[model samples]
Target chain A: MHNSSRRGFMGKAFGAVAGVGAVGSLVAMKKTWDPLPSVKAAGFTTLDMSIYPEGKLITEKWRGKPIFILRKTKEMIDSQTESQATRDIVVAGIHYMIAIGLCTHLGCIPAYIPAEKEFHCACHGGQFDWSGQVTKTPPPRGLDIPPFKIEGNKMILGEVGPEFQAMKDSGVTL
Target chain B: MAHFTKATSVKDWLNQRLAVEKIEKVMASEYWIPKNINFLWAMGMILAITFALLLVSGIFLLMYYNPDVNLAFDSVNYTIMREVDFGWLWRHVHGVAASVVFLVIYIHMFTGIYYGSYKKGREMIWLSGMLLFVTFSAEAFSGYMLPWGQMSYWAGMVITNIFSLGGLHMDGLVEWIRGDYVPAQAFLTRFFMLHVFLLPLAIMGLIGLHFAALRIPHVNNQDGEEIDFDAEAKKYLDGDKAGSKVMRFANDFMSKDMMVVGIYLIFFFYLVFYNYGFAMDPVNFDPANGLKTPTHIYPEWYFLWSYEILRPFSINIGLMAFGFAQVIFMLLPWLDRSPNAVPASRRGKFKIWFWLLLVDMIVLTAMGKLPPQGIFSTIGLVAALGFIALWIALPFITMNEKKV
Candidate 1:
């Protein structure tokens, strides 16, 4: 009985050690799949807000997604509700609506219609108004506002700032 | 006239070491198949043939196909299709086989359900087959990415985005899965590796398991009659072959399987030559553009039923329904509470359930392809709910079934 019990304990102990080694190896393998440090370093993009002209929507690539920066003309700003005003980012006293260009419905890049001051996703007919709020069905929510910080006349994207955090906390952006 | 004297010395030499004769007898010659089975029983062999075609054609494509995001499109369209000799033919073969293989699998799957092949003794066969289906789906999704087309990029984007867990903000996990914030070079290479190497290995392993599972309980027959396989084989061996209800799996059953395979290949290659356009999406002709998405995006036809389930609801609810659709088929053996392993036609309520499920899936597939507009959206919602309702109703309806 003593010999059999000792053998059982040894077998279990060896099995446990082997299991730990296997788990450690799996963790190491999984770590290799994460975004590399260089990819993470290239995550942030800084753009001079003043360089973009008013009323014209320009698309720039940041972290491989289209970033839509529309310097809101007076007419565009006048069309928003009190709630919509809060979604706009003011940098150097300039009102601008910045959002990740992909449609909220299925991630298609929505085209900005300068005439109507609205974004239209041709893929599914999902429409977003000047403030990046959905003006059509199918898109469950508004165009997602990217994490950004305003400093002087420059906007840095992919960085969490107080303003972005406030919008997130208010459930305005995801 | 003795067997050993007639056999070649090389056969004897190898058989002495390997027990080749015993293995052949065990796996093939002495293995029994019911005589009541139909041409639908040939689907397993047809699926194996299709897989071999995919492997061969994929290897040819891989020789010229570049995995880089910058070069992959041109490498496929310009280099292979335009430059390599008969490359278009090989591509058409691969494309048609990939699409047609799913058709065969569905027929195989539905035939199993119709015959109650997943009854108590054959759960492993069904489970392993389901595993193969899931793996093939992954392989197809990964292979779809290799073309580096508009549909490829956007499909990758939409699918990876699902990992966010219906608004839980699991972007970290999604990004890790894509190897970047979006589908890029690393994403393409990793998916290529999975499509070519990892997934195929898993599929081959699962196929082995599926066949091995079939060996013990043997295949289910059409009438669901339980035959005495050993006694029938004994009858055949005793020169009472005309009285036996079972036949050898080797020369006898294999000859029938080959006849069905020959007819299937004619139909398959007909599509490869004349109707291959159905398999290669026109939207995918445009190179992958991260900045642009096609006007309409959808998965291949095989995945349409489940994809439709993911639409027409709130994000979280739709995802739940989609998850349910994906896993429900695998649980059919458990959900079906019927006592008899008989055909659906004889199973009373299950007969209606079977046909209704098939029609609902076809409706779902059609709705999935159309733009989710006013009427289409309503129909899609109804059909999606109906699918869930049918599966939910399965156990209650089946539990009271009278055994045949």
Candidate 2:
């Protein structure tokens, strides 16, 4: 009886050690899947806000995703609801609508119509107003705003500032 | 027989060490199969041949294909198509087989369902087959991304985004899955690894398991009748073969299976030579652009039925329905509470239920290809809701069935 108990105890101890080694190996392997340092270093993109004309939408690539930058006209700024105005990013005393170009429905790029002042996703017929708020069915939410900070007339994407943090706190952007 | 008479012969010596004769008898020559089954029983052999074709063609394509994001498109379209000898033929064969294999799987699955093959003793066979289906789907999806075309990039984006739980804002998980904010070099290399090495290894192991699971229960037949296999085998051995209801799996059933496979290969190569364009989407011919998306983005036809279910509803509910559609087939052994293991045509209400489910899936597939507008939207909504309704009613509708 005593010998059998000793064998059981030794088997359990060996199993416990092997289990810990396996878990450690898995953790090491999983760490290799993260983005490389060079990729992380290329994350932030800075665009001069003054170069884009008012009411004209321009697409810039930030970390391989399309970022839409549209300097709002006076009429576009005036037409926003009180809720929509809170989502707008104001840079150097000028209101601008900046959002990731991929639609929330299925990640297709939404095209901006200059005359209608709205972005339409042709893949599923989802629409977003000038402030990037959803105005159609299908798309569960509006266009997502990228993390950014404003400095003078330059806007840097992928760096969280207080304004972006406020939007995050209010659940306006993710 | 003559070789076994000599003890020093290689066949006799190896048989003594390996018990080769015993294994051959147990697995093939003495293994019994019902005599009533038809050509549908040959699908398992057909699928194995198609998988072999895919592996050979994929290896030929991999010789010159590059996995880099910057060069992958041209490497496939220019280098492989124009430079390598008979490269287009291999691509055409691989493309058609990938699409045609799913059609054969659906026919195989519905055959199992119609004849009540997932009854008491055969649950593991059904489960392993379903596992193979899911793995093949993952294989096809990963292989689609290797060309790095317009549809490949956008489809990768849409599918990876599903990891972001609808309202929970799990964008971190989505980005982690992609290894970036979007599909790029890292995403391309990871999918390439999955397509070439990891997934194919898993598929080969699962195919072994699928065959192993079939060993004890044996294959079901068209009538779902229970035959006394041992008695029939004994009768045939006693020189009453004309009256026996079973045949040996080796020479008898295998000959029938080979006949079906011959006809199937002729049809398969016809598609590979002439109708291969139907398998390669026109939109995917263009290079990937992060700034642009095709006007109508849709998955390949095999997935369209379930993809349509995700549309026409609110986001969370749509995702829930889609999740249910993917997994409900795995639960068929449990959800069906009928006492009889007979064919669906003789099971009263199950006949109507079976036909309706097939028709609804066809309607969903048709609507999934069209733009969701006007009449298509209404038909899609009704079919999607009807699909959920039918599954919910399954257990109750089947519980009171009279045993045949």
In terms of lDDT, the best-performing candidate is 1
Worst 10 residues of 1 chain A by lDDT: A117-126
DockQ (CA atoms), all models: 0.57, 0.68
What is candidate 2's lDDT per residue for A9-116, written digit by digit as tens? 999999999999999998877777777788889999998988888888889999888998888889878877888898889888988889999888768898888788
What ranges in model 2 sit over 4 Å off? B1-7
Which pairs of residues collide in model 2? none
Give Cα distance to truth, residue B65, candidate 1, Å.
1.7
lDDT, candidate 1, A7-72, per-residue tens? 999999999999999999999989989888999999999999888899888898899999988888
TM-scores for all candidates: the values are: 0.95, 0.97
Clashes of 1: 0
The C-alpha lDDT values of all candidates are 0.91, 0.89
Candidate 1's docking class is medium
User: Over the stretch B303-337, how does candidate 1's per-residue lDDT look in tens digits?
Assistant: 89898888787667877898999899999999999
Residue-by-residue lDDT tens digits, candidate 2, B187-296: 99999999999999999999999999988888887889888788889998898887998888999999999999999999999999988998999999999888898888
